[model samples]
Target: MCGIAGILRVHPLGSEVPPPDVAIPESWLDVLDESIKHRGPDGQGRFRDRATRPDGSVVDVAFVHRRLAIIDLACGQQPMVSERGPYPEKPRNGRVAVVFNGCIYNHRELRKELQSAGHKFVTDHSDTEVLIHGWREWGLEIHRHLDGMYAFSIWDHASAGIYSAVDLVGEKPLYTFSDWPRHTLCAFASTIPALARFQRAFGITPRADTHPMGFSDLLAYGFLSDDGSLGYTPIELVRRVSPRSPIGIFATRGSVRPEPCNPDPARLPAFSVRNSESPEAINAGNVEDILNRAVESRLRSDVPTGCFLSGGIDSSLMSILAKKLIGELQTFCVRMPRLEYDESPIAGLVAKHIGSVHQTLDCHGDPSGDVIQLIRQLGLPFGDSSLLPTHWVSRAARDAIGVAISGDGGDELFGGYERYRAAQLLQRFASFLRMVPSMTRYRRREKSRMTRIGRLVQAAKEGGYPALLMIFPPSELRQLASFPGRKPWEDDPRGDSVSQAMRFDILNYLPGDLLTKVDTASMAVALEVRAPFLATEIVRRSMMTPVSALMPHGERKGLLKAVARKYLPDEIVDRPKMGFSIPIGEWFRTDYGGMKQLLLDTLNSADPFPEDILGIRINRTFIARMVEDHMDRRRDHSQRLYMLLVLAIWSDWLRGLSGTIRN
Candidate 1:
């Protein structure tokens, strides 16, 4: 819902102190502010100042914020300063300034508590102020007390440092460039390109030396992990503030970034799914109540709000609850040309049942062009094909409402992916398959699904469980990648295969791929999309519930369907899971050959990757073979080829990063 950027320079504690540059340049802030303007088109604000640490180190800071004005429109202008306490009379010094992105759904509840405890109210309702007060009340623990999807930075006037955090489930994102080794300095923002731009201001030349693990994450999976394996990012000097681990700088800034409590980015923090046999029975009614509250909270926007009614159990149920709360709601669906990939007809039924304003827009476009556009616009190499429809829907809905309730996070949390069922099958027969030797010889082209499953079973047996979710199996990547990457799944959850896979999705895929897809697609159009199922309580319940409840007798999303039956028809609840699925595979083979030509045209260029770079060097020999097999109909390499296209598109975009940053 917003764009935030800041620069912090402070000498590390006990290290020799250096006189920090107190001059905060307005031009640098201007560049940072301009880079992400689409994320917040309503207004902009900036804060530039310097403070002295208790250790006699000087810290210079500059904070810039762009606002979308979703709530408390008049008073929510940010780079907001807390002015409630009696302190230094300079009005600028010793005052906390917050630059934030995403929504705080529980701000009202926290405001009541803060007010009762002697915090004077200024804005009628500003979630930004609650953060200023909450920081005063709880310090770094403020993140724990808040229930929202957010990535925020608080310039701690008292500590002369920056305290930052993302939402617990990684729904929001924060990217950073830290030159802590050279000079205790860090620059952070909502998008990576901003930091890439900031790198020059810090006297560091921008380089695209792909962090090895980052490239690995991209190939092993369809996307890169926002939180890195060793707190590093796609670009070496950059890093992410891992979710739920409140990190900061300076002495009192609580477990600083370099000294994170848990360095692992692939597991949950502050909360993890504990493994137990005959795990405690969960109350279905409690789960339903939590979802009700979650949906209700998402409808708190001051601007006109709507629901993305996909007609699936998640979206339909979310719309039903929201309509009950507000009495009326606007719903929208995108109708695709491909019937197998469209849900508009069913969405119409749900919209009628809820009696809300509904519109179904015909979603047709140049698929290949849209794919290239999103890859560049996202400022990251994300390969989820669903981004096409998500962006189309968000762009259209942005004209009607400021925010939309999305049914994301439902699949990962409730075990809706077929991978979970694959995990079930793996558990029952993995050992037996291990006894039977994997066939060494194969026909040329992509392997059959059974062949793929056999490979996944072998990988799982060999401490490479992440391979089960890979874009390219390591066995193949070993031959294709010029530089190999380290396997990133450590501390695989202790449980049965199904539960383990569910937990893996929650910790890795949910945030890294799915949430990133939605965030990037929606934010590209400046539309706010909130996922109700990702709320803290609801996520906790899903984790605690037994695997049987989530997918009873091999039924994916069994638990959610049970809840949905109460509000949604059986026809709607029991429908096959296909929302925003792109028929790219069919497009490559059938009459929709525009995408096929584009894929060949773009990827078959001389060299798709920068050979000097740390990213995966494409062996044109290997890729051409896959293309030949696919074009000849010997193999269906839709996802694998799609990932290659995204990588190549990003490589092309990265080579063209001049003064102007693309949206």
Candidate 2:
């Protein structure tokens, strides 16, 4: 794992005086350059390419890289470039230059293929060189040919246009900024922090345009949400690019457009379908092979690596495979002080079984409802309470290692979520109940379902994911605030519940909640954390299993559990599924005082939220009420309260961002 920043000028314009030797700020570059130092501790390298003007004038393109040195510790320092004349007909012809951040698990295999095809290398340096050579041989088609998590930029002096691509699932983050006609361009460390650093150095301000897609996605998906390509970065005094589908950037002056390299939308892989096969009879060899390869690929990092053991099937299975891939792996776990919320003991058992160096941290003290502070650092409004613990664990690991492999995206792909079965059962129940007379169904005294159905009666009303993860009922949202019409569903197709639900999540929450939380939390401490379970290959493979295979016999991620048991002992595998959750549900009820005070105090202060328009007062009273209800067994409202608190913090951050963007 590493950090890369660069500039691409399309058509060099001439100037009266020769272009200044230092066009882009060295200070700005350094700030952005060192932002992700935790990702690359071994070394840093910078490359500058200058385009000559008609009158001997020149503007520079600088690519900066901070090395982690996981693969070729000795000579793998990057801004790795290919040697010329190695493959004469190739695009690079040994002329490609690249700064990459990721592990190409299949690089060894790729190397053998390239060598057989008469390609040569200067050194057994790193995957950086392999990427440059791969692009030279295949052009933009290289993305589909690779199998690993990565975000890379290859500057082919020959191609002139710098080509950059994020991994298919976007596990690795790559952000770009370009405004000048033939000048400023950048791709750097995890979040907008890198750009913020550049802003200070270059005396540039950031801008923000509220992308409608952001809100559309937020309401639909339980988690992933991006405001646009601009995100919460607040890039002012510059033209910001909108979020385009994942693609290649052949960036030069004349062609600033992003070209889509991903397959047609119609051809994208399916996520779930029903399968009649019994979990026990599913092929075990394929399961083991896919998982083992996933583990082996993530082990390609240059820095000392470790795993986050959550004591669940996913993490336990990951630990088992990791031990085989990297001998004596270091594993970390978090223990909540609350007994009901703790998984540390179970995690410890898994670590011991794998013979890992296990370390546990007790995080009982309040990070003090520090959600607002986290929002500022993260540059977005993310509502996952678990992000705090995830951040804490990654920070602890980064103290000893630069990169860590995690067991995320496993539940999303596999049928490990208990909710998956619930969803399936709900679908069936909804179908069965539809057969009853509408009058009979309506006459029943079950107020909750009847009330919920009443709200969904509006053709304009769209509810799916929100129904699953909603804190307040639609009726409650209606009671809280009076909007002019039904909720906006710009991303939804005319209130189609199923389509809207899936669309909202895949487009928004996948990137917003899950990916965002993991990316920012890990990167905040400069740790490069990779999720092998999210590999595109795994996604494609898992999608092949029928939905019946998804949640086998009413178990969440049922198919996945069977796969886990095949590779792991029943003791290590059959444990109940525990999400990498914080003790917030318990904390809200038992230790409600501090959180209540924080919320009430923040709300009372100078918050610019449209509380009158969106009447959700995220104060201490609300938290107390939630705790009160949970204790009295009135309702299960902790998650909702947590979401509200996150939103309160989020609303505060958005106001601050408004100031920055305007200024």
Candidate 3:
């Protein structure tokens, strides 16, 4: 894991302007480099290339890399350049340089292939070197061959162009800021904070206004999605490099736009299930083999590694496999004092069963402390409450190991969430519900506890499905926000209601919420977390497997349980799914009254809804009612109120940062 930032300048044709002495000021580079120091504290490297276009205009590119020496600690210094061919040490015309973040699990396999193809490597062993050689050998096709979580940029001096790609699963984040009007700069970074600092240092004011629709999307969905796509960060000026999309930019003698290097679907892995095969054929052995390979690949870290055991099936299975791979594995678990929120005892049981070294840290302290820090690190509003526990767990794990494997994508892959079962049940009754007349007229009066039938009826009446999971329902969001409601997923392709919900969760919720929570929390402490469940092969298998196998007879994660039966006790395999969650509702009522006060103060503040902050009027009465209901135990408005609190905290943080920038 590392931090990478780069700036590329594009010069238009017919402009006989002299090339600037320093396209990127050293001060700005220093600011960008220092801002993300937490991401990579081991070492730093910088690369610069200046090339003149055919029309006598010059384009400059600069890359800064912060390294966290996980693999090949000595030889993995980045901003790695390709010197195999006719590239000069300081190529006056062009050069090939790479700045990368995240691990390439298949680098060893790729290295052997490249070496066989006569690509000599100078470094004894470094994935960074593999990328440099791979780029030289395969060019943009390199991304297709990679089987890991990554976001990388490769600058080719010969073409005066830069090609960038994010991993297929978006496990690693990449943000880009393009200043096209000035035609002077295009910048990319691993975190938004680095970009914000770069903008401040370089005096490059963002031209775009706050995206109002994005704010509405955030308020409604607890995330910002533009035109149904869920990759948008809160900042309008910054756009994410969409997952699985390779983009290229060339500085031609004339005007130019970014070129999309769309991967050929044929070249990418496809998910398919052999319908003729019996469930017995997709047995424990086969599932175990896939999981073993996935775990084995992520175990390639050069640093001490551990597994985050949540006592859940997903994490327990991962722990069992990891213990097999690495004898005497270290396992970390967070123990909440609240019985409802704690899973440490179960985690202890799994750890004892596996006979691995286990450590459980109590989740203490005000969660708001972690929330504020998390929001600061995330540089955006993320309403996932699990972040509180995830942060504490990561921090605890980091004390023992630099790398930890998590079972993050298991729920999405194996239909572990209750929402999947609910969706399946809803689908089963959809026909019957369709036959009932006046079903739409049965309005749900209770906001907090809507029954399954009510939800089904409401969804049918709405002409669209509700989010399989939501912070706030659309109706409540409408009451809260000044803007009109819009169904972002209205045009999404229809399928099996359960499958549709699963796909939605995989594409949006998994990446936007779960992965973001893990990445930000783990990375905040410089702990590299790899999710074996999210491995390409495992993901493919899960996607291709018939939903029946995954959720047989209304059993959530049925296939996973079947696989777990071989390695775990029946009690462990058959245990009900208990999510890693905090008692936020309880906290709001008793333990953390200050949190409620903070929310009320932020909402009621004179400048609470600043034009640039939310860009809409917040219904104070509605918000007050939510607080009152939660505090008085009339309703469990924890999720909705938590979302609002996160937004308020994030808005206030951004305002403070802005004020500091002005000062």
Residue 312's C-alpha lDDT in candidate 3? Answer: 95
The C-alpha RMSD of each candidate to the native structure, in angstroms, is 4.3, 6.2, 3.8
Task: Give me the displacement of residue 382 in model 3, in angstroms.
Answer: 0.7
Across residues 298-354, which tens digit of lDDT does each residue of candidate 2 receive? 777656888889888878778888888778889998887667668899899878777
| Candidate 1 wrongly placed segments (more than 4 Å) | 11-22, 84-93, 226-230, 251-281, 435-465, 482-494, 552-554, 589-594, 658-663
Candidate 2 C-alpha error for residue 399, in Å: 4.7
- Which tens-of-lDDT digit does each residue in 1-663 have in candidate 1? 899999876644555544433345666787788888878999999887677766666677889898888999999998998744533433323578899999999999999998887777689899988888887776656776788999999887766778778887788778777775565666788887787777766566566656555666676677655454324455557777778466665533311243353233322422235333423334454667778899999999899999999888888888888988999789999998788778999999989877989999878666777788777766676767888888888888999999999888888777787666666666676667557665423323333665565665655554345666776766667667754645534443456676677767787888888888888888888899999998877776677777676667767888778887877778888888875677777777663737887787777776677665434566788888888887787766777788888877877676656332322
Q: Which residue pairs clash in candidate 1? A: none
Sequence-dependent TM-score of model 1: 0.89
- Per-candidate TM equals 0.89, 0.78, 0.90
Candidate 2's error at 23, in angstroms?
3.6
Model 3 TM-score on a 0 to 1 scale:
0.90
TM-score of 2: 0.78
Worst 10 residues of 2 by lDDT: 438-447
Q: Write the per-residue lDDT of candidate 3 for residues 1-663, one digit (tens) a residue.
A: 999998887666665544443557778788788877888989999988787776666787889999888999888898998744423442322357899999999999999998987777888889988887787777768887888999999888777878888876678988877665664577888888777667666675432234555665566567544232124567645677766467776765554345466544442233333232644233344877888899999999889999999999999989999998889899999988689778899899999999989999988645767787778777777777888889888887888999998999988877787766556655666567546553322322223234445556545434344443656556666788756665434423335666667766776677777877888888888999999988877765666666776777767888778877877899888888878888777776665736666666666676655656455667878888878876776666777778877877776766665553311
For TM-score, candidate 1 versus 3, the one ahead is 3
